[model samples]
Target: MLSRIGLRSFRAVRNPVRCLTTKTTITDHTTGRVITLTDPNRPEIADYPNPKPELAQNKDPYAKYDDPQNRRNLNDPVNIDDDLYDMWSPDYYQFVSDKTALKHNAIFFSLVFGFGAIIWYFQLNPEKPAMPRSYPFGGLAKELGSGNAEDDEFYRVKPDTTAEQELGFLDGDKDISSAKESYIQQNADFIKA
Candidate 1:
């Protein structure tokens, strides 16, 4: 409490929080000095700033190509002079050609690999023994004589109905053969069972 008010009689503090803050004091052999300082790095505002005039009274010249208010039409064909031909170094064209050649080589290799994969899939798989296959109707598909789609539909035997489908049969939507097959199987005298 005694150290807080020992340095200064009064402080110009706008906030009550700062007024309560105690300044640190340093003591040396020569004499004790109490330093009261603000932040040294605080920036001063730049002098002679352009004052913004009112929207109605403002008069500024329109910047030609960059005026956003009235932009030049993009579709207009007006050729500007080639002032920036030397924008890049002389060797830049060679570097661009090298990059283009690399890109074309990469595309060509990718196409070669893609064509190789397609050829392997179509021609090579048939020669291999264990090619993947699904027999939906029990390899009976090969027994069809003509192998045409029309004859296969007519001649193909009906696949057995699953128990779950027969159990879940709600109404007339159930297969007409389900009841007939069940009746023949239950009457055991017809077959050699």
Candidate 2:
């Protein structure tokens, strides 16, 4: 093991290619400054054999376009009102605003009238009671006025009956029979002939 280790070290020292490193050099033509790099991972700078040729500069690009044609004078009067920006005109804006307002008014009024009509229709065509509202104790005023058993009968509460008759009592009649007959007539289809 000792002889092997010494022989390997000797071979590594003798073989320079195995331990070789990369080197790059750069030189500035004008400043005469030189730069040297010894990093193996760094890229090399390529040098051209010939120098770059210089290009001529043009002072005047319109040198060939020297035509002496008729030109307008700078002091000539120009038309300021070209009518190109007609959208900014007051009359046009007013017309557009009026049209927009009219459309909005039409939609608003239509919605208002439509909702009003719907409400009116519901008011006119109400949901009728499934069973006609029949109060056993004819008038609340009579019962509320006196708790007497004598005033419980029909004739005893004359004032309430008269008031009820005046305010269009059931079927606009005096008795419950007439009201029943009227209800039967109105819903004749539901009852037998």
The most accurate candidate by TM-score is: 2
Clashing pairs in 1: none
Pick by lDDT: which candidate is best?
A: 2
What is the number of backbone collisions in each predicted candidate, taken in the order shown?
Answer: 0, 0
What lDDT is obtained when candidate 1 is compared to the true structure? 0.43
Tens digits of per-residue lDDT, candidate 1, 14-113, equal 2112211233322221223333323222212112222332221122435343433423334433222212222221222324587898999999999999
For model 1, the stretches where C-alpha displacement exceeds 4 angstroms are 1-96, 124-193
Candidate lDDT scores, in order, read 0.43, 0.48
Q: Which 10 consecutive residues of model 1 have the lowest summed lDDT?
A: 12-21
**lDDT, candidate 2, residue 124?**
66
| lDDT at 108, model 2 | 99
* TM-score between model 2 and native: 0.20
- Which stretches of candidate 2 lie above 4 Å from their native place? 1-99, 115-126, 136-138, 146-193
